[model samples]
Target: MLYAYLLSVVRTVAPIAAGWLITQALRLGVTIEPGPVESLVTGAFAALYYAAFRFAELKLSPRLGWLLGWARPPEYPRT
Candidate 1:
């Protein structure tokens, strides 16, 4: 549980970094002005993208093994 919780923090921050990257690309390639509204839309879209993938990796496909940021699986003791 703790492993997942820690991994979840990485998952949460990844979207923000991706959002900034996307926003920079748009600013360079497209003529759209960088403002609050543009940032807001990019942030929402990045969040959605992360949510979709996270859901698929964790819920839809469990066998893929840490497609996100998880370095390894958690270890559990057996009796």
Candidate 2:
């Protein structure tokens, strides 16, 4: 659980960090001052991108591995 939590944190932070770095680099060549709304939009987009990537990763990986197997499967009672 802790490993999964850490992985999630890393995934969530990485894109934001990269975006910040890219914006800083662009600042050297261009005068771009983003407003609060623009920053919020950018952050939301980054979070969506991370979620999509994580979905793809979960779809690709096997279900019976050590990472996923740590969680117990849901039990649905018969109707």
Candidate 3:
């Protein structure tokens, strides 16, 4: 579903975005340049982290059901 796709994209991008912000902050105080290679590595690591997180969530869903309360309920369940 659209929601799932959006969540996946957010999860994948969040760490890379955070890394970029942190690097920018450090650059203000230090002479550090995260060039294209660093960006690519960061993005690759972010995707790996997202995949691991999603795998864990799916594997543990039964015990983590409470964390997923935001999902839509069955359409016919409510009166």
Q: Which candidate has the top score in lDDT?
A: 1
Q: lDDT (CA) for every model shown?
A: 0.72, 0.66, 0.66
- Work out the TM-score per prediction: 0.37, 0.39, 0.39
TM-score, structure 1 vs. true: 0.37
Q: Write the per-residue lDDT of candidate 2 for residues 1-79, one digit (tens) a residue.
A: 6776797999999989998987987788965566866997898898787556555545754343334334333455543
The total of clashing pairs for model 2 equals 0
Ranking by TM-score: 3, 2, 1
Q: Poorest 10 consecutive residues of model 1 by lDDT?
A: 64-73
The CA lDDT at 20 in model 1 is 95
Error of 1 at 56 (Å): 0.7
Model 1: per-residue Cα lDDT over 1-79, one tens digit each? 7777787999989979987987898889965566977887988898787667677766667544465556344466643
Which ranges in model 2 have alpha carbons more than 4 Å from their true place?
30-79
